[model samples]
Target: MLFQNVIKHCRHYTAPVSAICKPSDVFTNLSNEFPYYLPKIIKTSLTKKKYEDNIEIKERIKNLSEYHTLAREPIQGKLTFLAFDALAESKDLTEEKLHQVQVLAWAVELVQSYFIIGDDMEDNSETRCGKPTWHLLPDVGLLAINDASMLRSFIYEMLKNNFDQNTSTKVENYVNEAFLTINIGQYMDIMMSKSKDFNKFTVEQYNFLNDHKSSFYTVKLPILLALELCNKVSQDSYENVNKICTDLGILLQMQNDVMDYIDRDSAPVKTSSDIQKKKCSWPAVTALQHFNEEQRREFMNCYGRWESEKVERVRELYKEINLPHLYRLEEQRINKTVLEKIKKLPDNATPSADFFYKIFDFIHQYTEDISPSILKSNVSMSAI
Candidate 1:
């Protein structure tokens, strides 16, 4: 119901259907061109390794495309195109300009693929989108590390191929900033998980983790790229749109932290690893604050442990404190708050406010139309 109520009073979404790129179109373009940088990457693998006789490595290079060709919602690409398309309405974007947007959008997905592959390994995650993660595939254990790096290398290659020298340099700054922030955030996350010290698992720390680790790169980067292309980087609207991106990033990650604890059928759960892994997630932080002394002892005892009985104790404590219901209330408040913030962005200005509103519209459709019973993994990926 909070999901339904959210964005209800936000501006009525009025972006023209003809003016925007569809998710299906983004997906088609991404899948069609995903292999663009593979040959070059494989050539490097073959030449650099000097492993022509190594059948296992040779086979990996031959089949590298399949690792990246996985079908996805491509929310980042879609958002990038929407932001670019929104700006286009003011001054018509040429076909070449639109093509450049597509190239960057493609690169965003490559970044995402790298994150998923590497994060899964780091978290010891077993499945993704209902399939075993890349590292779990035959003969891919530690080599998947190189595979993930290979995926990341394509992003720079795409940028170099598509943008002018000055523009390429500018975009590289954005890429470097995003990569560094996410890496630091991830390091903090893994450190906290390993320690399992409730003193360090404060809400303030969780907010830091959420903003840097998942939100900035997921929400902020694509929007920044679009603004960069529009030459709106110098305008005040840049910071205005950025604040909104930050808010939505907070909201998006809160959804992930809460959803991690929600019970579900065996299939389709991307992971409940957050609990067993002792992630300093939202629910854990919230519950820690409200817990009594005995409760705190019990929680710290059960949390972050792998055994089923300990995991069950965490579940029981969550139910006793009504964490799921508390999350619903908090979500409703944040959802309304973020949508109202988006509404305040000037529609007639440099970066159209309509873009952010329409981005929420896409999220609205995904939440309402797709997988109502349980929000799909895409919900965790992003929409804002």
Candidate 2:
């Protein structure tokens, strides 16, 4: 009964595309048959594994998408603004590309939700985007795989309805490639963390993870999508975009690693997912790099264990190594490189190099990783 009355039901599908076509609308018009789109697959995986007729079960399955939607950030959605902004950078955004942006941005949201749900399940994560993981909900265990699949299905359905054949095909190709690259990155993360052998760790490994794991989908895909919408995609432009995203993506993962440790005590939404999961991140790799043979062997012994004492030892080791100081130095270097790459963006990339600098500042402030007591110490990060 999952799709039962999904469209015909007035309450769930009542809002018109016009009603929720604005970026401010969190739902993104899916409930209202966006672009006259509808799912064609009847036996969705939600039912492929198991099907339930209970109204509440259906409601919980629905929330798989809604929860992530409720917690959605504008990280990717904001890229869609390139289209609206291209129409008038100096002028305020009117309806000049509102509908199209809304549709495409929602597609991004759906795809993101798919990945988040799957990641949570894969990590055995307790929460996502500050809410309980969907897979952890009552009667939802294992069924979340199907729920994530369902979210993914919407992305293609909606895309088919909204974009031209050429743009849609290009976007589909990028998305397919991102899925493969991102999965490989995720697999590397899982395998590396599980291995936990000091010999397996390397700076080169960290850079590889950053390339596929952090940046491609998050930065490059959205930027490419935005370029396509703005009629600016070119081989040369993509090369520049790829380089910029790789640099920024590395910095982004570094921030995630450092910020988790630095803001662990104070930041409202801080998480130690990386530490708990034993993921190969900037801090973990860096800490191991600084460790002597004995120290590295000692860490490997208990690094990935979930027990309280083991986790505490890992935390103390991070402090003992002064990871915060190392992170600040790396942050400055990475940010400088990112700015230089942006400056080389052919001078016609949307929003210009100056705009990315502004974004770089906004990213820092938004992340609020500056709250670390150590960060406020002798080093001045004003240049970054």
Candidate 3:
């Protein structure tokens, strides 16, 4: 599992580096401070034999760790551990900053778990990270919402417990701001799904949708949270980090869309969740805007419908439109632009270049292996 691997890697580091050795340890330590720790409640309740015998509740909690391990297990815990270790290595990280980063990492993990739980329910998904999704197992369903909410509450608890001091107001403020941004992005994504005409979507709209819905949570929030934890509280700091992180987030999401269409080995059952949901993904909206009228009509006919043959027809249109080539070009361009932007950051303001570099490296490593076929064609957003 990624979390386990992360724990192992962090432990391998000597002395101070070992502080972040275990995420569960981090969560447990931080949660001890919260006035109300829901995981403690869930944990206590689940340990009761009767509760475990309930079968349904057991499955949901059981799946929680599984969903988390998906992101952690593959990279051998390198992502979170590396992020945390960067702070450990920093000569400037105050005790408060160090604690904030730990709590922040915990908060982000909680948020991610919340999303995965709710997303599984929303998509009616059956499995995640090789096991049944929370909603799919007996006795789970709507309770998954509560489980997700528990994850959200954990964020507040961590904040209140660890950052209640006056000096930490900036960290508090940034956390709230990032939360608002994510909510706004999620709202836009839901609204786009209900939109009437797929053809009406512009490339700009597609970019906006992807930037908000996918980018903020994955890229923007994590890095911004890091900045906040580092006590880099100036508006300039937030703005610079936000812009860079948002761009990286958008690129990561675009790559995700591309991967869904192309990667056959992906754990998600179907690749066309975005198409089925009528998401205004970059490729879909781009195709709609750029393809000739005849091709456009063909695309509309096949767009979100579930038939296998029609999905194949959509793939054909991508090839005809040279979408794979376009996607490759756009990806390379965006990556280069992001790298240049990162380089331009004032040396003092940015963390070690290796920190940012590792992040981009992880994104590239994950998405680069995906075949162009999955990327150039439309796929389901729900799958993620």
Best by lDDT: 1
Whole-model lDDT, candidate 1? 0.67
RMSD of candidate 3 to the truth, in angstroms, is 9.0
Query: Compared with the true structure, what per-residue lDDT tens digits does model 3 show for residues 1-384?
Result: 122222223212222312323344443343343323334434433453455467665555545533553333222123433454554534644556545555565555555566667666666656554467766667766777787765565456556656646634655565566566656766777787777777558867767776666666666566666555555446776676566666666766676666555544555433246666666676686677679989988988887777878877877787788775677667677666656666566666655444565565555554444464433232222223
Local distance difference test scores for all models: 0.67, 0.59, 0.56
What's the best-to-worst order under TM-score? 1, 2, 3
Count of residue pairs whose backbone atoms collide, per candidate: 0, 0, 12
Each candidate structure's TM-score, on Cα atoms with residue i matched to residue i, is 0.80, 0.74, 0.72
Which number leads on TM-score?
1
Lowest-scoring 10 consecutive residues by lDDT in candidate 1? 364-373
Local distance difference test, candidate 2:
0.59
Cα lDDT tens digits for candidate 1, 218-332: 7778888887888777657667766776756766676656656765443433656778988888889889987889988999988988999999898888878988777666666
Better of 2 and 3 by lDDT: 2
Tens digits of lDDT, candidate 2, 77-171: 55444333433333333343345556665565556667777777777767544557778888678988877786676566556555678877877
On a 0 to 100 scale, what is the lDDT of residue 340 in model 1? 77
- Count clashing pairs, candidate 2: 0
lDDT minimum window of 10 residues, candidate 3:
1-10
Please say which candidate is ahead in TM-score: 1 or 2. Answer: 1
